[model samples]
Target: MDAVSEIPDYVKRISFIDSNYNWDNERYGDKLQKWLEASSDNRLFVACYDDANALLDGKPFVSKTGGTWHRTYLMQRYLKKKMKRLSWNKTENDSIIYFTADNRRIQFYSRKNPEQKIYHTILVERNGYIQSVFSGTKYEGMGYQFMGRKVYDMYRQNSGSW
Candidate 1:
């Protein structure tokens, strides 16, 4: 187990997803760092695409949005470039897919309408964290809970561009 200070403060029992699918260098770096800190990545279990070189080759991302295809062009391109970072594998099983990481096995999923979407959405997450994408100025996120205290997105968030 990591020391409390070493771990990023994740939203317990809840997760948020920002549907924007944004990509900015600083934001990307920040998000990546946070993810590495919170995720189950050690030396052996292996994270899919943390390495920049691997990303250039393009890993496994959703070629198809199993539910709602509401992604912007920028989002699509970003996914193509950094899709592997989002998922551990390309194999599609069901809505909730599990992958083993550093310390434990984690699952990745999204809040999409099965009636509308294809099935799988994006990838990557923690037990108590908010999974958001940068939207240039701010993070556009969606909130979901799988484990501890409920994550309320509206609390720390405010309206308008900062």
Candidate 2:
């Protein structure tokens, strides 16, 4: 499943850090550097796109905030590993869908237990990477808990963007 090409044309483009464009090179570089260095846990995982026109396009990146560094780092690492393990395949067993909020359409994919219909992992896709990730065990039911709401709120407060 080629996620990039599969993105619908209607989604807006947002820029992110990559080999050609580093996060430090953007207008918010100084603040981003300070944020990234302050605490490892205070971060928001975001998806990016190379061609979309929204504020989160380009390479997937993490935004810093006033949260627990270790947990965020662990979640980021875990999501990355899980995404890699899934091979980006979206089939009936692995559901991929989109929803509109704040005037933007967001893409999400979920890995669920087939027989029980319980989700193990849910990830937001941006620039072909996992932007936001949520996971739960079958014992916990299907409700998904977002990891970095505070970080994301801080981003909205500072950047006037989402």
Candidate 3:
């Protein structure tokens, strides 16, 4: 857990598509441009493309609107990259928290002291954000309680962002 904090925050390159057909078919080329331009709140940070190699100097954030197809596209790409990095091991111990964009679920898995492992999943808005100290899976009580409170607390703490 300490390692997670030590790893400096960096901008991430979010792709819009992957070889797998996990996203709905849609070509918003011009519409996408117009939508992004019209909604100032819908802008994505340029630094996001830097990946973990370069730390972002500014705070990170994502803006989303009524574009399911676009989100699905992004998810496919994001998942593909993550999957490659994960080597198809969804249950890998390295991943404690997983934002499964395709399923719209954020899963938190636990690596118990010895050999126990548990997982909990919660739905979240695509571009929504959360700051949390996610409890492990075996402690279902804390996990469930934090599920509701952590998000609210993060929202309250980051009120100015919205």
> Which candidate leads the pack in lDDT?
1
lDDT of each: 0.31, 0.27, 0.28
> For residues 1-162, what per-residue lDDT tens digits would candidate 2 score against the true structure?
123423333432322212112322223333333343343332332321221111233431333322122222233344334334222222333422222121121122222222332111212212122233221112211232332222233223545445
lDDT of 3 by residue, 27-115 (tens): 43333333333432332211011121112244322223222223443543454454343222243344222333212222222222121
Cα distance off (Å), candidate 1, residue 59: 30
Q: Runs in model 3 with CA error above 4 Å?
A: 1-66, 78-128, 131-162
Question: Best-fitting candidate, measured by TM-score?
Answer: 1
Judge candidate 3 at residue 28 and give its lDDT. Answer: 30
TM-score per candidate, in order?
Answer: 0.26, 0.22, 0.21
Error of 3 at 18 (Å): 19
**Rank ordering of all candidates by TM-score, starting from the highest:** 1, 2, 3
